[model samples]
Each structure stands twice: as structure tokens, then as C-alpha cells.
Target chain A: MTLEIETGGVQLSTPILPASGTFGWGTELKNLVDYSALGAVVTKGISLHPRKGNPQPRLLEVPCGLINSIGLQNPGVDAFIQNYEKELSALSMPVIVNIFGESPQEYAEVATKLSNCHWVSGLEINLSCPNVHAGGLEFGSNITGVRDVIQAVRNSTNKPLWAKFSHSTHLFHLVEAALEAGSNAVVLLNTLPALAINIKSKQPVLGARRGGLSGPPLKYVALRDVFDVYSRFKCHIVGVGGIIKPEDAVEFILAGARAVEIGTGAMVHPELFIKCRNFMSEYLKNGSYESVENMVGLAHDDQHV
Target chain B: MRDSPTHFQLTITGNEKVGDRFFLLSFENPGVSFRPGQFAMVAISGEPYPLLRRPFAVSRTPEGTLQILYRVVGTGTRLMSYWKKGRKVNVIFPLGNGFEKIQNACILVGGGSGVASMIALARELHSRGTPYLLCVGTKKSGELDPHSSVFQNPPLNVKFATEDGSFGFHGTVLDLAEQHIHSFTCAAVCGPPAMMTAFLERFPDVNAMFSLENHMGCGTGVCLGCAIETRNGMMRVCVDGPVFPGKILLPEHLK
Candidate 1:
């Protein structure tokens, strides 16, 4: 069965990819993960300058999910290139760098710098990180802001650009604005904004007091958004959020996600990508689908294709 | 090619209740040797209730099997207690930087469940012919398994302290350590934050290393969930260290 497909102007050997932040430069878990099963490696978010991230207690685990406020801790763009460029370039798979910044200018600057690295196949513009105080959910929630950041990054490089959005009430407008600003595809549903309280401490559990929620609980929400967005707009959608099992990936594809990024689920099971690929291969064969592309949005009552 | 960390499904060989809430669990080793302070992320083979795998310090038994001394403190450990012999468990081992070997005599301090990490280090020191003292502290005598291999006839020196005054020394482990403060040139500590803080505060001059425990999403470096602020900057407890120099850990880290 054919698992290869094209999304956001980039060719993926498989539809399975690691979500930003969960993969960490795509090389950290080389020993544990089977990179051959991955279509592409998405690095953690990189800003123009180094960030110390949030204070301690950056993560809290609830029933079937996790809440995190890492605040995009990374070694600025330059350092990332210096540290990971060679190793990332050596990988047989494509490397998609997740870039974030405090302003449109900062986003463009990081994009321009990353564009110089030939190994970087695309840029996943992070406009929806909830852990930060600025530039993340702020730009993602505003139509004008989304256009400005994507447009700015678009002007910086000719490489494929995928705009990652958080769950917003105005998600359609944001997607429209991003596509108009030259984003090749839109990554549906970054983590959902949530909070947890420490009853014993009588305060917030996370150091930042709030963090984005990811895991099994997010799968249905992300699928609904992907289906809704795909029906409304003729744009490519990358499905993300709570994909723990292989069936979850199939569900996202049925909901119109051309590609799926596994986040928290991958952390829970390191071999998730390989398991997903094997499952998908068998799924396509059994269903008699021509390709993963043929199966996208098959569940829609009034399919877009 | 570089040796990669192994992830495997191993069967439990033994599980015995040793203390009030403590259990000594043994499983077949996957043939990967681990450093003294390194740990493993463990999960039930097919269970997903706890979602994330729990991290535990890995120790090797005299019989060539791997064991972890865990206290029933949370859902993960409570579930682990029900794991019977022959049950398969998913484990990723030899993760994180371990304690650095010191040339001089050292003091090893462990409190509560943290003492699990010290046993491996103590054995390594003993084999290397390094003189070391292992000081373990717990709330009460019932908290430790005195018959466990860790406390069995090894030519190693060990001391215990119980807060309830039912064990070796009547006060905290730090109180027992006070009498030998000047005997060792360096110290390695793993325990509650308060105890580690006290060790740093009371013995500021001694070079020390501390093993830290934090809520981890992925025992690998990817999650960045276990990042801790240090003198250098934010360091991930999973990759950079589960063991860190006492000097690099900030005061806030101790609290």
C-alpha cells in the first residue's frame, strides 16, 4: 500500500510525523524511535533568541493527558543550526523546523536563518503556543496577526510553510488569513489551553499557572476541527492532538487530515510512528484503498474531493 | 555505531513486599548495563491507565536480574505492586546522566524512596575498592526492607536513621551524617527536596552531587518536562542528568 503523500508542498514518505516540541530537534530520541518509520522530523519551537522557559513544575499529568508550560525553551535559531544542522542534514528523512518568535519581524528573521540550511525541508510556523505570554496564542487568535506572521515568514523563504494553529473560536478566519498569506498548509489544533490546580498547595500546579493540554482527550476535538476546516476551505490540513493509537490516525485521515503529527502519544509510546505506519499499511490493504491520499476525508458525508 | 538505549518487554521474575508500602520488584535484564545513578522508565505492557511511564532507578541483583525498590506513593507504583511474576513490562533503560565517580572517599545519602538510587552507586564503589558510606533515612523502620540484597552481607559500610526512632540513629539521616561530616571529602545525595536542601546548607564546603526526581512526560529528552533551572541554565533531568552537581542546582531547585 502507498503511504507516501505530499502535504504543504513537501513530499512525505509516510503520513506519520512527530509533532513539534514532542520530537526535540528530531535527533534526541534516535536510540528509542525508529526514524525510518517517520515521514519527517519536526523540531521543537525555536525563537530568535534563547529562552529559559518557565520555572519548575513545568509539566503535570492528568488521567489520560499531560499539561505543559515549557515556554519554548530553546537555544536560539543560530545555536540550533550550529548544533543540529549537520546531524539533521545527515538524516535520510526530511527535517521540518518549528519556528516561533515574539513578533512578525522575529519570525521572519528566524525563517530567513533556517532557510539557509538546505536540510530544512519546511517551516512549521508556531503561532499557537499557549505557554508563552506573547506571539504564540496572541498571533494565532487574531486574523491580522496570523497574516502578518505568515506573510513575514513567506517573504523570508520560498520553502514550504505550515501554519500551526491553536484551538480558537475564530479558527476559520485564522486559517483563511494564513493561507492567503502564503502558508502551504495549516496544522489543525495545537494543544488546547487548560489549567490544573494543586489542591494541597492551594495554587496552580504548573509554574506558568496555565499550559496546553495534549493526549487522548484531544483526539476528538482535533478531528472535529480538521473535518470542519477541510469542509469549509480548500486547504491542506495536518491533523494533530491526542493520537495514541493507530485507529486515531485513521480517524484523523477520515476527518480530512492529509498528514498527522503525533505529539504526547509518541512520548507515551516511542515506537508509535512505526506502529502507526505498520497499522496504516495493513489498514489500506484491507480497506482496498489505493493510497493514504485516497482515504483522506472518506468519512465526510459530502466529501470535498 | 553508537550504542542506543534499549526498549523492551521483559517478564517479572519476582515481586515481594518488603516494607509497609515498599516492594522489591525483579525482572529479567535486557542485557544493557546501566550507570550507578541512571534510571529506567517503566510501564505495564498493555495498560494505559497511568498514560506516561514512571521513572525508577535501576539496580542489578546478585543473580544478574534487574530490580527497582519502589514505594506505593501514587497510582503508578500502586499498579506496579499488582504485577505478578511472568508479567511483561515495557521498559526503557540506562537513561540520563549518572553520578560521576569520585576518586576520594564519598558519603552517599538517601532518604525514603530516594535510597533506591544509592544502592547501585554503593555497589559500584564497593567493587572499585572505593571507601564510601551509605546513609539511608526514612520515616520509620517499617519503611525499609532490611533483608533485601541492598542491606545483605556486602563488605560495604551502611548506616540508617529513622524519624520515628525505631531504626539505627534516632533522628534524621542528616543527623547521623553530622558525626561523619568531615570524614568524607565529597558526597552524593538523592532524596526529598528538603533533605537535599539541608545537605547543601549544612555541608556547603563539601563537593556534592544530587539525584533529582521530577514529573516526567518522556524519560527521554524530548518532552522537556523535567527541565530544572540551574546555575548554568535550564537542564533537563532526563538527558542532562538525573544526577547533577550540587553547586549547579539553584536554591529554588532545592525547594
Candidate 2:
């Protein structure tokens, strides 16, 4: 059974990729993770300028999930290329740089610079980072915002573009807007916007006051979004949310995700990529499925009338 | 090139209550030695309630096993307190930067679980034949485990301070260190935020280094959850340091 599959014009050796923000530049965990098991490495979100991120208490662990408000803390685009370009270029697997900006112009400029780097496999447009005050969920809130950013970025580079979206009331329209604006794929669901409060302090727990929730609690919501988008559109769907176990990845695949991105789960279990890969391979062999491509959206076929 | 941290699972050999709130946990050594002040991210093998692993300063026992000195504070630690021997735990080890050795004799001040961060440094100083003093502070005598490996055989020059005056010196650890300020040129400290802040405020001239603790996600640099502002701008506690020079630490950071 071949695990090899293609998403957004980039061929992956496997269907599992590390979600953006969880893996740093794809090189931080080189010694700890098995790179061969991943389809590609999505970097932490990079902005046009360095961001200091949120203050203290940036992360909080809830039941089966984590609420994080990192505020897109990054070294900026130029610095990222300077510090990690050589190592990232040398990696045997593909590198998907996740880009963020405070405005559409800034997003385009950052994309223009990354387009110069030949080793960059694609650009995962971060339209749904809920932690920041600007250019995060704000840019993906409506059709116009999604179109303007994706169109601006698409005009800036010829690289594959995967528009990452957060769960919203009009999630499908946002997916349609991204595809209409030239996004090659849509990453269904970034994180669910959530808030946590400290009862004693009578204030929010996170420095940013609000954060995005990820982990097991997010799995069902993300799977439903993937199914909805897959059934409605002809675009590629990369499932991401709370994928902790191998079976979780399979569930996403059957729900119509061509690929799945491991976020909080990978931080907790670094070997999850390989574990998911192995499990998927066994699942295909046991079920007599020819490839991962065949497994996509299988659950849709079994639905009762 | 610095060696990358390895992820592995180890079986718990011992987990015993030390004091009212502290426990001494040990496991078979994976033959990976850590520098003084380095830490590890640890979690129970199969439990899933507490999603992320907790970071703890690592120490090696005289009996050739690795250990972590921890205090029962929250759900994670409360769960860890019940961990029995033979249970497997996942760990990512030899993480973050360790304390740098100073040339002159120095004073080491540790408060609460921060005392565990000083043990390896003290052991290293003892082996180098460098004269140093280890001053440990606790709320009271019940919070300290005198027989734990952290305070065992070596590192003979020792002192104790307790807020409740149940131990040697009364008042905070910094107040006790002030009595011996003239004896050492430098100091290494790790403890509660208030205690560390006091050390920085009181000893502006004395060369010092502080091992900071923060709520961390990934002990690796990726999470960026443990970032602290410094003279050098924002730096990660998991990578740039769990240890930082006292001079570079901004006053606003500790608070």
C-alpha cells in the first residue's frame, strides 16, 4: 500500500505532516522525530517583522485540550531564512512555510521573499490564527478578507498555496472564497476560538486574554468541517485540529482529508508522525485499500439514507 | 555542535514521598548525562488528562539512576505523586541550557523546588575542588528532605533558611545570604519568583545567575510558551536558557 499522496501540487511521501506553530522551522526536532515518516514540515507562523508574542501564561491545559495564545511570536521572514534556510533546504522532505502578516500588503511581501527560496515547497497562508490582534482570524472572517489576502499572496508567488481557515459560522463560504482567489488547497479548521478565566484573579488566564483551543476536543469539529468542505467543493483538504492517535488520522482521512497535520499531539508525542504513518499503512493493507488516495472520504460512502 | 535531546521511555524504579509536598522520583539512567541546571519534559506513559508534560530539573543519584525532585502543586504533580515503581514514563531529556561555571568561589541559593536545580552544580563544584556554599530555604522544615540525594554526601558547605524559622536561619533565603555576602564573589539562584526578584534587587553588584521556571509546552524551543524578555530582547526559557546571567535579566521580567 502506497502512502504517497499529493496535496496542493506538492507530493508527500506520507499523509502525515506537522501542523504549523507546533513544529519550529522543521529542524528543532530533527534528532527526536523520524522525518521520513512525514509528508512535509509546516513551519511556525512567520510575519514580515519579528513579533514578541504574548506576555506570560501563554498556554493553559484543559481537559483533553490546550488553549494557546502565542501571538505569532516569530523571528520575522528575513531572519527565519537567515537562521533556518540552509538547514531547511537540506532536509530530505518538503518544507511548507506558514506565513502571517498584519495586512494584505505585508502578507504579499512576505510571500514574495519566500518565493525566492527554491527549497520552499509551498506557502501555507495563515488566515486563521486566533491569538493575534490583527491579520489572523480577522483576515479569514469573511469572503472579502479571505479573497484579498489569498489573491494578494497568489499574485506574489507561484508556489502552492494552502489557505488555513478557522471554524466560523460561514466556514464553507470562506473555503470557496480562498479557492476562488487561487488557493490550491484549504486546511480545514485552524483552532476553535476559546477563552479561559482564572476565578481567583477574576481575569482571563492567557496573556492575550483569549486563545485557540486544540487537542482531542477539537477532533470531531475538525472532522465535520473536512467532511462538509470535501462534499461541497473540489479543493484539496488538509485536516488539522486535535489529532492525538493513529486512529484519529484515519478518521480524518475517511472524513475527506487528503492529508492531516499533527499539532498539539506531536508536541506531546514526538513519534506520532511515524506512528500514524505505520498505522495508516497497516490499515490500508488490512482493508485491501490500494493507497491513501482511495481512503479519502470513505466514510461518506457508508452514510445511511 | 550541541547534542540534540533524545525522546525515550523509562520505567520508574522509585517514587517516594520526601516531605509534605515533595517527592523523590527515580528511574534507570539512560546513560545521558546533563549539565548542571538542565531539565527534562516528563509525563506518565498512558495517562491523558493532563495533556502536556511537566518540565523538571534532572539529577542523577549515587546509585546510578536518574531522578527529578518535584513538589505536588497541581493536577499534573498530584498525578505524578501517585506514580508507582515499574510504571513507564515518557521523557525528553538534556533539554535547555545549563548554568555556566564561574571561576571564583560562589554562593548557591535555592528555595522550594528550586533547590533541585542547584544539586548538580554543587556536585560539579565539589568535584572541581572549588569552594562553594549551598544555601537552601523552605517555608518550614517539613518541606525539605534532608536525606534526599540532592543534599547527600558531597557539597559539604551548606546552610538552611526557613520562613517559619523551623530551620537554621530565620527570614528568607536572601536575608541569610546577605550575612555571607562578603565571602563569595558570585551567586547562583533558583526558586520562587519573589525570592529570585529579591536576589536581583538586593545584590545588584554581586555577579549572579538565575535559573528561571515557567509553564512550558514543549521543552524544545518550538512552543515559545516560556519566553521571557531580557536585555537581548525576547528569549525562550527552554532554549536560550532555563539559566540566564543575573545582569541581563530585566527587573520587570521576574515579576
- lDDT for each candidate structure: 0.87, 0.88
lDDT by residue for model 1 (B84-184), tens: 99988888877888877678899999999899888888877887889899998999887886766666725458988999899789999999888886899
- Candidate 2 clashing pairs, residues 3+ apart or interchain: none
Q: How does each model score on TM-score? A: 0.96, 0.96
- Tens digits of lDDT, candidate 2, A1-305: 79999998899999999999889878999888999889999999999999999887889989888999988999999999999989999998889999988788889999999999999999999986432444345888888888889999999999999999989889988999999999999997888889999999999999889898988889999999999898889569999988989999999999999999999998988988999999999999999989999888888865323
Q: Count the backbone clashes (under 3 Å) in each candidate.
A: 0, 0
Cα displacement (angstroms), candidate 1, residue A222, comes to: 0.3
Name model 2 segments beyond 4 Å from true. A129-137, A302-305, B1-3, B153-156
